[model samples]
Target: MRLGYELKEAAKISWVAINSNRLRAALTTLGIVIGVATVSLMGSAIAGLTQTFEDSLSLLGTDVLFVQKFNWATGGGDWREMRNRRDITLRDAKRLERELSMAQAVSVEAQSNGLVSYEERSASSAAIVGANENTAMVRGFLLADGRYFSEADVDGLRPVCILGSSLAENLFPRFSPLGERIKIRGKKYEVIGVLEKLGGFLFGDVDNQVMVPITRFVSDFAYNPDVNISVKAVNTELLDDTRIEVRGIMRKIRRLGPGDKDDFAVNQQDMLMDAFMQTGGTIAAGGLLITGLSLLVGGIGIMNIMFVSVIERTKEIGLRKALGAKRRTILIQFLLEASFICLFGGLLGLGIAYPITLLMQQVFPATLAWPVVLTALLVSIFTGVISGYLPAFRASKLNPVDALRQD
Candidate 1:
């Protein structure tokens, strides 16, 4: 009871001292306040960026794999290597679809650049994608109006099209695009579906393109024989097994000899995620390093202020030591004073940062999670300990006779 009482008395004295020099104490805490706010904001921004990337990539589907002539992330960053590999074609996509039992769905895809026109309005150099009926399922495309292409449309080589959300809006802002005939390179194609808005991807825009039947694309642009194949696993648990089965089926279809190496790449979402994480990590590390320097400066400032406070309170400390006060009491009082200052500053920082985080939600999702808040408080307490220890020790060890002799 006595120890507790002494500790409470010490805290009261420290609080009183802080109130006596309110402006000086507030100025002393400014460094800590700025440091905490900056670090918290940086952490939240990085998390927001990560969330945005994942949401954008969700259009690719987590369980789907892309079989192509080259890997987009790796492969020595050489185009010649990709070019020298055998071209993946629509036929390969068909063969894979027919032979692979592990795959729930497969689609053939190819791209070209063309101008889409609707009477007075036109978008030049628009992305043109060629796909079969399965493309809608494999690529996670949703329609805002009308329906996706049917099997009959693919078989008969119908000049049917689906406009991306932005494309539809640009071409037919005032009216619906369903059943409307649009021209692509002087060739007429009827808009059968207008895809729902998919925002954008870092790799490409998902809402500024058009999809047509594979046959229609082959007829219009025959120069590019390269086709990409997308395969979706039956379920999440079967992804690995499905990849293995796909590799075997693909190897047999390509007629590679027993000794020959595979020329194609089997890509899953993990590959893209891995690449993204590597880049994200470097950026996050750089940002944290800069912010860490700010924290170090703050810690230094706290240490400087605590030393000054000890010097100013030398006589009071001497008077207490001459009485019944122990060395531990003096140490605890100084430590509590420093801790209270930092804790107060940290809470103030959080208050200021809350509004900024809410505003950031407009650009990206910056949530002030409980874990981050708790961590900031814990970090404030730790900073107090590290910065206040030396000063607290010096005050505790002061000789009563020498301290009383000081002015």
Candidate 2:
């Protein structure tokens, strides 16, 4: 009960002290405000990027592996070797399909860019995907409307196409895109399917493309273009085995001898995820260092102001000690005062961060979660304790007679 009374008196004194010099307290906490705001905003940005990347991973297909001529994670030094490497071809995809027993599906995909036009509306430089019937299965593309082009469509080199959601909206805004004929590279093809919306990925927008049969793509666009093969595993459990099988078969298809190095690369969603994690870690480390410096500066400012406050309140400390105040009570009063200042600054910082987080949400998935808020507040209190300790301790240990003699 005595401890509670001391705490109450201490809090009352702290509040009055802060209220007496509102402008000074606000100015003193400016550093903390900036520091906390920057930390919160940076954290939200990293979280947003992580969430966006993870969401896009589903579209990349978890159970699938991509066979390509070059590694997706290759550095600049390896570019020359990759450039000289032979292009992954249709024959390699066919061989994989024929030999790989663990694969559920194999797809040959080629890509180019061209104008897609419907009546007067046209989207320029839209992505053009040359894909087989199994491409949808391997790449995890789902039809939003109508149906995917059949194997017959691929075999006959039929002028049938699938529109991405964004492209369909741009071309046929008012009605369904099904059965509507659109021209690709000046050749007319009927729209057989419209794909569900898939936002931006590492390469570019997935929902701004048109998919046609690989055979048709070869005939319409460049002849015998280099292609990437996508192989979907029979099950996720069989993925590693499937990858090994694919590598061995690809090596055989290329006719590499026992001592020859495998020229091909097998890529997966995990590779992209690993690259993103590394990038995120680097960014987080840098951001933490910058924010830590800001907090350190803020803490120093708080400590400086606290020392000044202790000197200014010397007479008051003497009077309180003379009136039977305990050493702990004096310490608690100054500590509470510093805490209130930082707590106010933390709240203000969050207010500033909230709107910025909202602006970031427009581009990604940034959010000010409760855990972040709680952490910021806890950090504020912790800073207060650290900054106020020296001054509070000195105030607690003052000689009443000596303090009273100070003018």
Candidate 3:
């Protein structure tokens, strides 16, 4: 009964404190509001970006592996390590295709940035991918219209091209692009097909690009005879064997001794994810540090306001004490008021955060994790309790006579 009565009295005192200084209470909560909002926003954005990357990575297929001059996922390594390396040539890719019966398909790509023009419309520094027929299967490209280049086109070095969806839209927005001729570096090529819209990847929009035969690329635009290749295993079960076979083929082509280390890199989607996660970890840590500082400042604001409240209501405290209020009651009252301030601010922050997050999702379709939201709320509550301690202690420790005598 005593504890219930004390709690009731504490509630009454907290209500009075809150109502007595409406403007001050609002001001006190401002820091908390900003802090909570920032933390929530940052958390949501990071989670959304992570989800976006994961989705994009999933599109690449798990069983596929890329053999390239430089590692795509892991960034720059020792220059000396790559200095003596010879490029993986079309012959290397051919050998792998012919010898590796266990592998499903092997494809070679020679990429270059060039100007593509159709009539008066043109795009400069556009991605021009050079590959054979197997390129589509290895890279997961789907034809929205027409057909991919065939073995005849590749072997004959025919001046035929496939347009990415975005490129097609940009160049020939109102009509079908099939049978139209586009110029690449003053060379005329017929658009044989249009690729489906693939959004954007780490390498940007696959749709806003052009693809031509490997033979044409090599004959007309081969900057170097050796370029990297991409190979896909028959299935997940064959991935290891395929890798081993590819390594042996590459070593033999390069004439590297058995004891020589590999001069090339084989990268996969998981490797990309691992590299991204490491970078993301650093960014998240920095964001958390900034958020922590903001939260600390907000907590201090709450503490300062509670202290001022205690000073302003010293006589009220004395009056309650004289009427048989316990120290614990006074402490609980001030603490509850402080906590209420933070929690109120947190609710407001979340209210604002939800809509902003929704807007972000609309702008960039991304997944928002609920755990992040719950964490933000919990942190705000914890901040309130921690910040209120000093003020509540002061209120509890005040002498009744002294408090009453204070004007």
Candidate 4:
């Protein structure tokens, strides 16, 4: 009951401090507000980016594993060395398919960036992927209209194509791309199908491209001396078996003997996620370092304000002490006042941060995870206790006779 009464008294004193030094309190808390706001906003943005990448990868199917000449979307290591590596060709893909009974399906792809044209409309710098019929199943591509290229078309090297949703919309705005003739690299090809909209990959939208037979691609553009082969496991449960089988097959195909390091890379969803996480950790560390400075300045400001409050309230402290107030009471009151200021500042910062985060989400469709919010709140409260300690101690140790003697 005495603690409750003391708390009420401390609350009343904190209210007095706030009401008396409104402008000074605002100025003092500004650093804290900015620090909290910055940390919260940056965390939310990073989380949103992480979620976007995860969503894009999830769409690509976690069961699929890519066999590539080099790491396709991760870790920058000796690109020149990777570039000099040999290509994985259609034959390699065929060999893998034939040897690996555990493999569900296999596809080979080559890509060129070029202009796609349909009469008056043309899309410049569009992605043109050369793939076989198995690409539809492996990449989870769905047909919006008409049909995907058949195995016969791929084998015959027929001049046929499927338009991604964006490419179709761009090249054939007035009518459907299916059954229409589109020119790619000066060669006219029939659009056999239009692919449904599959939103952005980590690189960008899969729907903003065109796909043709791997044979036709090789015949027209030829392999750039370096092409990647993508392999999908039949079932996720067989992932380990598939990996072992693929390693054996690729080793035989590449003619690498025992004790030789594999020249090629096997890329998977976890590899991409790990790469992104490492990058995100670096960015978050940098952000925290910058924001830590701001929080330090805020802490200093809190200490300064409390010191000033102690000096200014010397007469009040003397009178309270003369009237039977204890040193502990004095300590608790000043500390509570400082803590109140920090808590208020933190709440205010959150008010600003949350709305900004919501605005970003509305504008960019980004995800803001709850953990980020909770973390920011906790950090703010922690700042209050740590920053207020020294001044609270100073206030408690004041000599009542000396305080009363001061003007």
Candidate 1 structure, TM-score to reference: 0.90
Model 4: weakest 10-residue lDDT segment is 221-230
TM-score of each: 0.90, 0.93, 0.93, 0.92
User: Least accurate stretch of 10 residues (summed lDDT) in model 1?
Assistant: 72-81
Question: Model 1: per-residue lDDT, tens digit, 268-380?
Answer: 87777788888888999899789868877888899999999899989888998999678999998888888888888888878877899999888767777666677777787
Candidate 3 has an lDDT of: 0.83
Best by lDDT: 2
lDDT of 1 at 376: 73
Summarize candidate 3's per-residue lDDT along 124-231 as a digit string, tens digits.
877888988888998899999999989999999999999998889889978998999999878999999999888754546587789999999887777565665778
Instruction: List ranges where model 2 is wrong by over 4 Å.
Output: 1-5, 73-77, 200-204
Question: 53 in model 4: Cα distance from truth in Å?
Answer: 2.0
Which scores better on TM-score, 1 or 2? 2
Model 4, backbone clash pairs (residues 3+ apart or across chains), number? 0
- Badly placed stretches (over 4 Å) of model 3 are 1-12, 72-77, 223-226, 358-368
Candidates in order have lDDT scores of: 0.86, 0.87, 0.83, 0.81
In terms of lDDT, the poorest run of 10 residues in model 3 is: 71-80
lDDT-better candidate, 1 vs 4? 1
Model 1: how far residue 77 lies from native, Å: 9.4
Ranking by lDDT: 2, 1, 3, 4
Task: Choose the strongest candidate by TM-score.
Answer: 2
